[model samples]
Target: MEYIDLYLIHWPMTVKPGKYEFPFPKDEIEPFDMKSVWEAMEECLRLGLTKAIGVSNFSSKKLHALLSTAQIPPSVNQVEVNPLWQQRKLRELCVAKGIQICAWSPLGARGALWGSDGVMECAVLMEIAEAKGKTLAQICLRWVYEQGDVVLVKSFNEKRMMENLDILGWELSDEDNHKISQIPQCKGYQGLDFVSPSGLTNPSWSFGMVRFDSIIVERERLQRTVGLIEPIVDSAVIPSGIVISSIYLKYKKMGRIPEVLLISAAPDSKPMPMIGFGTATYPFGPSEAARSAVVRAVAAGYRHFDTAAVYGSETSLGEAVADAVESGLVGSRDELFITSKLWCSDAHSDRVIPALRKTLQNLQMEYIDLYLIHWPIIRNFALDREIPPAVNQVEVNPLWQQKKLREFCVEKGIKICAYSPLGAKGTVWGNDRVMECEVLKEIAQAKGKTLAQICLRWVHEQGDCVLVKSYNDQRMKENLEIFDWELSEEDKYKINQIPQQRSVPAEDFISDVGPFKSLMELWDGEI
Candidate 1:
């Protein structure tokens, strides 16, 4: 073990150099210098001594300060959380910063010296455990897991460990979640031993425990700001988009448009939405922004969603859907259509099912509405499958309309779902060619529409489904407004005359040793 997987600061306080002991001298206590300490953590990451660095017991204020000066933001924040102490405020802050919460003492450390019996003895948890036929600890742990946070439970006994791991296969009902939400909140652990007399300031808390003074209060006063301590909108209260960047944003109920049957022959096929939201973003990684954006999209009436394993958005998309359901934005998961793709690397026969299963797991869904081979260059896909492919998703925009493939797919009863419909600006495979087209610009100006709206309208008018990606609240709603308007024949003619070019060529998939050897071979001269 040359390198550790994760390294975290145990506490956000410092003491004099000596053999470690509790109840340190007040004169020896010192404020934690976050900037210098985080710099060293960054150095540790750079030197490959640790895969990730983070902090434990960091309140929202401390985490905010560290993030402000951090070259590399904390990957995780280890915090104490349970039904008794949900830490919703702290959890929201961490989510917005893209910091994962690793819940310590998730069961409230019921038997430890610093633990409380509140979580273990709560009547709400007891009732849930009895009704569900599970242990109280299991019920507590499952609730934390459902919050999209990691749970840490220590059990040396074999049977107890097995019980802890068994929380995954099933879920708590919405009623159970509601009951737990009403439980009185109070933190279990109070680090009063570390609060020095000299540094002590505010001492009282809801639980009647002495809160650490300088660690929680002073640091908060110094670090808290309108931007840092500001809370994310509670979907239950707000149930819509919130103000962002000093702009009030409200996601309009774009309403459900007609769904197109993907496979006319398959009796079990679900209809795919004609205009879907794309969750693929450049600098691909899962973040709260992705989840929050998807939630807002759902509020704005987006039913069909496009995600892939490689895009790294499946988890966030899944979480967002769960949130939407919990918030009553949608009746259930079945009401929304979700489509995921098999990555090119997993195109082999042996890998396909496993990849799809992993995709389902990431999405936390039993089945996918539509699944497509992300690209054709991976391995040769046989057409003799038990289920025929329903859709062929590719790059399509005003500049590159993919006329040849579009006609071929429509003739074969397969729908064409267009990705990069606006040239996918700011990505390695994307360029500004489509957005900067003079012809589309003139048409957009004349019609009093944004350049993006013009491109999407053209794609929708072509009888092809469009996948539009946007994180902005106003833009997300604006993308869905293309259904009402109709593009004129002259506007269509001008768009058709634009020079055609593919935005995303499979150069990365091509290699001398791999299946695809060149661009021409990959696309079979389609480009």
Candidate 2:
């Protein structure tokens, strides 16, 4: 009982109906009785024989049948999963059912048993591994590790074992993640013995068929159980994956909003955690006050930190991240997703890389998780760079949602993170039109939520990410409560009925003598 905490139903097989396999006469083959077996497992849980029970090699079709009848729902499904396999069908089913997924041989075996090493030999995985200064093994492990699933790497050699353990302390970038997805999927381990015609398998669905119900369920079971993002590793507990919005967050328990609320550059790009820490404050530089606020956010489970060099919080954010890791609030620099923007002054192609380098130096990190163009000014027309921008941070709210620009960017496979999501209430540049709207106020009262949450949730529910700033801890926590619940159809219809207008009439860009003589010309009439 003490040695093993989790006992699994390895495969969907049991003793032949009239023949007992456990006390085998070394003659009879095992027959399938998955239902009765699972019931027995539940009884074990009731008797305290095991803390949890799950299954392995059971496809999504099998899982659904089990869930419908299970008295104690299985907590996890262990399987031989890898980048080569992709496991999209199983992953989707697992995400919806709140069952955690853990991988057995995450890296495909070739020399060990299988003739071909799909994962370790793949060009994309190799390329990513080289660029990230990690082993192919590490890349494969990290890929699944990032999937918010526990990866089991089998190696007795000290160096390779060390490499497996080194999965922590660093991470794979979205670029690497995209490349891995580009590799065509082929399962490395087809070691299922029960798939043959004579072997026992589910009668309702073919052994290979993996279909499930359309109903999707999402629960952050992995974060609460494994705590994989924390520094103190649990010896007995393994990591797991939860389906949130059909995207894998790679140990995204650090993601404050659970159930996979993320924004991606591409459908395949490593999805960016939804909420971001906005540093566009009254006094831009990372003062002690600004740094303290970020630190508090870090402690409160924020991984995406948004700052612009112009905001003057880069250095303070850098310092704060270093402090956060040293203080054990965060596990590593990679755990927090740092986003920095290029100010308009450095918008020229020649100045872009140097400006980004300067920002990286200020943040005191080897690489920034995401670097963006701060503005869409005329200078952007002439800008150039080797690395493309990941996101375009702009002012957007219900009043100025910029639906057209967002669609264009989505086609280009670039994400849009809305700043000033809430009407920047305290600033001269912002107005109270959104927060003070009568419709929004009525919706807030009806939902029993704050006006700020209503506004932030609107942007989140629109399938976009939002940046919000709150120095107040209580307020910051409130802003992040978007994913737990959702807006109703009536509330959404009321919001859509809201009148739209451009908040920032860029008069500064218009001059009688300049090219943009009117605000319409300045924004091409978007204003």
Which numbered prediction scores highest in TM-score against the true structure? 2
Residue 63's lDDT in candidate 2: 85
| Candidate 1 clashing pairs, residues 3+ apart or interchain | none
Give the Cα error of residue 224 in candidate 1, in Å. 46
lDDT of 1 by residue, 1-527 (tens): 99999999887777777868765666677555678888999999999999999999887766777887899999999989899778777787888889999999988887887786768887779999999999999999999999999999899999999999999999999889967764535556755445443333223211111122112223222111101122234322111233122111222333235346545424333356677888887778788999999998876677788898999999999999889766645545766789888887897899999999999999899988877777762122222234345677777898788787766665565667788888988888799998888998899999999999999989877777888889898888778778556788898888888888778876887899976698777776766
Tens digits of per-residue lDDT, candidate 2, 1-527, equal 45357879976655355843333332233446667888999888878888888998677667878887888889889987788666666777788888889897787766865424656776667778788888888888888988878776778799888878988888788767765654434445433223222232235433333211111111112222112233333222112232212111123342234212123333222335667888877755568888899888876767678888888989989999888766656435655667787887897889999999999999999887677776554112112223344555667787777777666555454456777887887876787888888988999999999998998888876546678899999998787677556788899888888889866665776778976788767676676
Steric clashes per prediction: 0, 7
- The RMSD of every model to the true structure, in order and in angstroms, is 21.1, 20.0
Give me the candidate number with maximum lDDT: 1
10 residues in a row with least lDDT, candidate 1: 221-230
Off by over 4 Å in 1: 1-256, 264-266, 377-388
- Alpha carbon lDDT at 514, candidate 2: 71
- Clashing pairs for model 2 are 95-243, 96-217, 146-250, 147-250, 284-311, 285-312, 286-312
